[model samples]
Target: EAGVAQSPRYKIIEKRQSVAFWCNPISGHATLYWYQQILGQGPKLLIQFQNNGVVDDSQLPKDRFSAERLKGVDSTLKIQPAKLEDSAVYLCASSLDRIDEQFFGPGTRLTVL
Candidate 1:
């Protein structure tokens, strides 16, 4: 099967602007996650969901970042009023369960000016 799919592979926006990313994970994978990978560092989990229900979001900046999984299939992540520090690569991953191995998408790179 093909890998996960993400759109707008690259994006650039000014501070305080809004941006959104889309992802479609492998079919039948129930667990989905969004991550932020800053340059030079490992990816940090932003939010996670299992079949459209949130599993964890403690690391997510709720004030500006939001995410949702539609019908337990596709997912979307958004960042509003972005800040300069928000510039990073946003990745999407999926797994059969919380403890299972995950498949990751190429990611959408965001550059906040």
Candidate 2:
């Protein structure tokens, strides 16, 4: 079982710019996760989904950040009008379920200037 795969390992953009990230979870995984990890801080759960239905997303910034998992498979996360505070490593993870061990991607490093 290989780790999840994310594209464009690094991204740099000005404040207010928009960016989208793609994630492909491991095969047969029933749960997917998105997290934001700022410098010096632990990864924060942005959203979680179980088989295409949102399980939890209270920590997500709904005003500018959105995500979707289609067919309970691949997922995407987008941040519009990116803010300086949004600069962080956006990580994607997956598990058999909420309590299962999570497999994480290397992450997309977003640098907002």
Candidate 3:
């Protein structure tokens, strides 16, 4: 099966600017997740969606970050007034079920200057 897809493989922006990342999960998958991975650290869950409804977003930085999975398929993540700390790899993953194996996208690497 086709894997996850992501856009703008890389991004460079100044602090406080706005940026958005897009993702398309695997077909037939029911669970999608967005994660932020800083250098030398594991990917931290930002948000999780089971189909069109949100399942978990405890780690999402609501102050400047938001996301949506309107159709329960593709999704987008946006950061308005981005912070320097936001300069990291944003990853999108999907699983057939909550306990199933997850497939990850290539990710969007953000750099803040």
Q: Which 10 consecutive positions of candidate 1 have the poorest summed lDDT? A: 1-10
In the range 38-107, model 3's lDDT, one tens digit per residue, is 9999999999999989999999989999999999999999999998989999999999989999999999
In angstroms, the error of model 3 at 101 is: 0.7
Best by lDDT: 3
The digit string of per-residue lDDT tens for model 1 on 28-107 reads: 89999999999999999999999999999999999999999979999999999899999999999999888999999999
User: Any runs in candidate 1 off by more than 4 Å, and if so which?
Assistant: none
- Model 1's alpha-carbon lDDT is 0.95
lDDT for each residue of candidate 2 in 1-113, tens digit (9 for 90 to 100): 77799987999999999999999999999999999999999999999999999999999999999999988999999999899999999999999888999999999999999
* Candidate 2, residue 2: lDDT: 74
Instruction: Give the Cα lDDT of each candidate.
Output: 0.95, 0.96, 0.96
Model 1: residue 28 alpha-carbon error in angstroms: 0.8
Q: Give per-model TM-scores.
A: 0.97, 0.97, 0.98
- Number of backbone collisions per candidate, in order? 0, 0, 0
